[model samples]
Target chain A: MEGLSQGEVIYIIVLGSLGMFLFIAGFAVFISMYQKRMLQEQEKRRIIELDYQQQMIQSQIDSQETERKRIAADLHDSIGSLLWAAKLNIAYLGRLSNFNGEMKDSYLETMKILDQSIDSVKRISWELTPEAFHNTGLSSSIMELCSRLNGKGQVIVFKEKGNQLFWKDDRALMAFRIVQELLNNAVKHAKANSILVNLNWNSNRLLIEVQDDGIGFTLNDKIRNGVGWWNIMHRSKMIDAAIEVKQNHQQGSAIELTVPLSS
Target chain B: MNKLKVYIADDHTFVRKGMIRLLNTFDRIGEVKEAANGNELIALVKKTIPDLVVLDLEMPEKNGFDTSKHLIDHYPEVGILILTMHTEEVFILNLIELGVHGFLNKSAEPEEVERALYAVADNDFYRNEIVNHALRSGVRRSTEASSAKLSPRELEILLLICKELTPHEVSTRLQISEKTFFNHRSNILGKIGARGNVGLVKYAYQNHLLELSA
Candidate 1:
């Protein structure tokens, strides 16, 4: 106090305080910026992981579809041809007048069996990969599926609203498969007697709802984690579609899938 | 007895040939012609019209649906038999509406096929037990939405009516004036394409608007 000047002491204090303030301000800005960068990096990583998962699901569905098609082709071409040839040969033998009654009866039985086999093979192949799904679009194929499923007291009421939609082939196929899985679930698990399939086609979206008068489900993580629901969810994600499964308390379940119209 | 000339149109060689052979064996069928696709059938039919044309639904050039329409338009006299594997009610109903004479499954027995051919040729229409059962069940699946686009209030009134409530009782139950109730009832009848309350009840049952369980 006796040696230092008042002016020098004031200057020293002023400089020290200013330096401390600047340091604190700079540290605060650096921390906020660093935090923002870390948040952005986490978002990027999450997106990348999601994208990877979608790609894997898409590829998995594609490979399964390709395998099904290959098997269907094999069944239709190889086995179907053999059965037809066998039936045709039997028919030709039947035309021979020298054949005895017993031989003729045996030939007739063989032809019938061959016809049944041909029908079965066709059915199995068609079930695996529907020709209508490729050729006639989604609506007709769904109707075909409904008819096939609607035998033996189980009733499926199908209704379509608005003009027929023109959709991308792969997306349409995925949607069909998803609906098929839902229907199969209804039959196999839901114990549904009557199912209603309603399709509403708007200008910008196609909404399909499958409602069943069955023992509805309770919305739970376990339900979503099931293989059928997981497959549906993955397929829906692959096509950029949305799905909502509602379970009524009394006795009904409905699954709604909405797909945006391809621009 | 005049032999029946049949025209068979199918895309598959196996199905086409098998059907052709089966038809040839039938004593009722005199001459049988084959077409690999709808275009060929249309061309062949234009030249020499068969008594009946057995059609497949899915074909290359034109589908069976379009072929049936074309046949009905041009050759109205020819009996059109849909021998499709498609047993869907919508297909059957649409074809029936298009004035097809008969509907037969491909898996039909040879005897049943003969019966259908004969019945369709002789009569204006044919409905076997299979066709009859299918039509009955399929007709029950008529478009429920198309039958009526009603308001919630109107639907509530409809359920009341289906429950056999009198107009006065319904008006009281709904807390609406009798005149207002009558107005709603008229609107309901018009929307549902029903003639009166009786028709409304029938429509309600048919469209499943009346949930019996409820």
Candidate 2:
């Protein structure tokens, strides 16, 4: 070994170094493959977690719809009939008191108004409870309500811009309730003169957009802390849609609802 | 004197008919007409120019607000009264701006309506006490506008402005002079950090200055 030529020794050392480098490169490749495998497992677990969350949301929605239908039916069928009977009794009271002077007329008038208020509350209750909601599909129902409301202040423009708005029935129902509640907020809170609503199917998603030229507001405002905003947000979760609420550049607030048609 | 012509606008037929009966019981109310919805009421108001219009808040075609506003704009001489079951301050606040001359809950005693008819017909403001209480309660919850130094009178005035009222009309409602009303409006704008009329209206709306009824 000591008698070996200098060139031969140098060649040996270079070859040995190249071999060590190849071994390290091979080990790095193996480690990279191991890391990729671990990432794939984590992703699979994450997907499972997401699926569980979706199922839980769906269960909650199903329960909520069932509850709404039940409560609405109770109010419409049970309480409504009772109110009607009471109203009829008031009319009957008119028959007993005929050609009355101011005092008797006053008595009869009080009775009649008492009956009218009962009726008004029942109607509002029905609208809130459920029966009125189901009789009409969400779009037509909302349009009817807003159309009725438009007569109140400035014209509230309500229109659906898309062709295929049919969604998973639960999602549709929840979406309908959400829009109804938001419209209530607009009318009651925004002091909005004109409310413009847009609903449509965008690409593969069902989109609901509510914009108002009235007083626009940020979503995180304290007024949104109650059941109204909570309901809208929970419903958005049901359809896997992300709601982008921002002030419209012109003057108002625009709520953009984008829900995927497919899971 | 001739009877003051009266027309009724309410969604419920029973209520409208009841109102018609109540008004006719008095010799002061004459040629009582009835409309079941806002559209009918508007058409009737335009056609007849009734001395007094009694409208309900929740009606189809045109609601009480629109119908009343239309009547006020087109027939300023005719007194408009809002007879509603809800006496929420917010509703009254909104009505006040619409220049609604009289406010009464449907739950009011029959005499209240007759009194309201007389006062409104006489071109006087009748602020239902229940409504004031509701407004006071609603204001208590939203204090965002409290620090702005808006006097109670200014708040009442601010509410009317929100309904898109002209300053002249605001003067008539509050019994203030045109000059004072202008000065107050400017002061209100300055205090609230609002630029123009819209800005004032927007700030009032956002700060829950408008007594909003459910």
Candidate 3:
């Protein structure tokens, strides 16, 4: 300390301060870079989880559809056939000449019950999985659905315009299911008296508009958390369709789905 | 008239037995045979061709579609009556195109079944309300050519055919001989490029020649 000059001391001090400032700056850069890397890894994991969730939902829906088809086939093939056979046997018994008036009346009543059972089975089977969907495509199936639902209190009017194009079976089924859910919601939840389902087919896309004359609903937590709505949302996502919900001013609500046609 | 030989094909034993029993009650039906599936039905048919074959659509060995096709191609004279649970228009239309003589729902009353069987046996084609409704709504227009080359009389016959009227009825209604009706029918088929009655009904609907009514 006694041998050092003033200029040398000043130089050493300046050099030491410069080295300190460089060390602090380098440390700051390293900390920021580490945080950025951690954040990127977290984001990647989140995306993977989301993809897994989507796959799970998709499989769930597919399994449900398979189950429904199986049940429908069983109902149609087994129960329906059995009921028809019973009705025939009853009819055969009625043709016999040994029956008294009371027995004949009982036979008639039995026949009527059998007929109603047969009808109920047909309706239930049809509702479970529309067999027409496989043979006639989406339009005819939707028309049939509308007609089936029309006379039972609520009047569902289905209007289709433009040339109908062919669709992939799975995608078409999804669309059909979505429309079915919407109609169900309108009837059961919204208590709609009249509903209009318009399918406007364009060259590249299909625009579906479902409007109902019922109590309108808000996009609240209850609806968002509902299984039906959740299913609709997930199905729309699967089909890559854009969905828009609009509440009418006076009454009811309208849902518009824009579905891209690949074929 | 000779008694009609009938064949019943169904996977369910009860259904087949019930159907046989019901047919037995009818004095017109004779030699009622039974088969478990479409293949069995075909083999039985090969031995002795029945006047009418009642087929269930869903079967184990072969489906009704293939069986009916084979029968229509091989034994064109044998009447193919589809007596299944399917009441879809598409099924009806497809079977009709395949030249099935009749369509009857499994839930149809035994009387209706008898009527369908007799109709198919006598007239060669049985037209029920289901078939009529399917013809009206299921057939779609194929071409933009609105001009169907047909005389007014041919058009009238075509409409009657679409209305589920048999050849005899159409002839009687139009005050024409059966021979004249056949000639007109042939002319209509040629003009519209149709193969059979199903084709004629389809053409009538496609050309908007037949009005859509209940």
Clashes in each model (backbone N, CA, C under 3 Å)? 0, 4, 0
lDDT, each prediction: 0.76, 0.68, 0.84
Going through the candidates in order, their DockQ values are 0.05, 0.02, 0.61
Model 2 chain A lowest lDDT segment of ten: A76-85
Against the hidden reference, what TM-scores do the models get? 0.56, 0.44, 0.86
Give the runs in model 3 whose Cα sits over 4 Å from its true position: A1-3, A98-100, A161-168, A201-205, A216-225, A248-251, B144-196, B207-214
Window of ten residues with lowest summed lDDT in model 3 chain A: A216-225
lDDT of 2 at A193: 81
Per-residue accuracy of model 2 over B44-141 as CA lDDT, tens digit each: 87677888888877676788888877777778777777776444455555565455677775555556777778766652445456545544544543
Q: How many clashes does the backbone of model 2 have?
A: 4
Best lDDT among the predictions, by candidate number:
3
Candidate ordering by DockQ (highest first): 3, 1, 2
Question: lDDT tens string, model 1, A118-218?
Answer: 78887778778885455457887787789888974689999999977745387888888888888887777778899999989988889999999878765
**Clashing pairs in model 3?**
none
lDDT of 3 at B78: 93
